[model samples]
Target: MENQQQTWIDLAIAAMDKAYVPYSNFPVGACLVSKSGKVYQGLNIENASFGLTNCAERTAFFKAISEGEQEFQYLVIAGHTPDPISPCGACRQVMVEFCEPTMPVLLVGDEGALKETTVGELLPYSFNGKDL
Candidate 1:
């Protein structure tokens, strides 16, 4: 699983080419590496409404869940920016609901940078099904 996680992160980095972010021009790619060793990739798609746009993290997570992947244990986000790219609040919420507290979220930059953090550390008070 270790090697597969790295492969998924690289795949997420490669998925950035499919980003359709014209407004912010900040293309982002994400990968949800499932516990079953499946890797799902997502590229940010923008909408004119802006509010209707979906983030790469959620897209990938939803895609995996639709495919019967209910146990995603690792996520990696990559962008062209110099700094590591983290998930947005909405994405973080989705992740909190979709994964366990110990799941790792990896942030990577265009220059092949890396920052690995557990979901528990990144989101202190994440919303879950119990929150409602």
Candidate 2:
């Protein structure tokens, strides 16, 4: 599990380097591996209208879903921040929609800081579209 998560961490950081962040200059990247062995990666995309921006976590998840991946087991998020930054509230909610409740979320920051947690722990009570 450690090795797998570490691999994703490296991939996440690598993806962050490709982020399109010309506004806040804060780059984020995320990578998720489906149970079927497919890998999906994404980088933060900023827009002139900040409200139109999309998070890296959701982008990666959606990209996978678009590719027909509906089940995931691992997620990795990386950024050039001081500490490990977890996913946003919206991303957390979207994650619970497709990933298992206890799916692992690996967060990494600059200087190799790493933390592993679960989606259920991050968002104790999650809801699907119908639940809302």
Instruction: State each model's C-alpha RMSD to the native.
Output: 1.4, 1.3
Residues 34-112, candidate 2: write the lDDT tens digits: 9998889989999999999999998898899998999998999999878888788999988888877788888888887
Indicate the residue-level lDDT of 4 in model 1: 76
lDDT of 1 by residue, 1-132 (tens): 678767888888888889998899988999888888888999899999999999999889889989999997788899887778877888888888888888888999867778999888888877788967
Report backbone clashes per prediction.
0, 0
Q: Give the 10-residue window scoring lowest on summed lDDT in candidate 1.
A: 1-10
Query: CA lDDT of 113 in candidate 2?
Result: 80
In candidate 1, how many Å is residue 57 off? 0.3
Best candidate per TM-score, number?
A: 2
Clashing pairs in 2: none
lDDT measured at residue 42 in model 1 versus the true structure, 0 to 100: 94
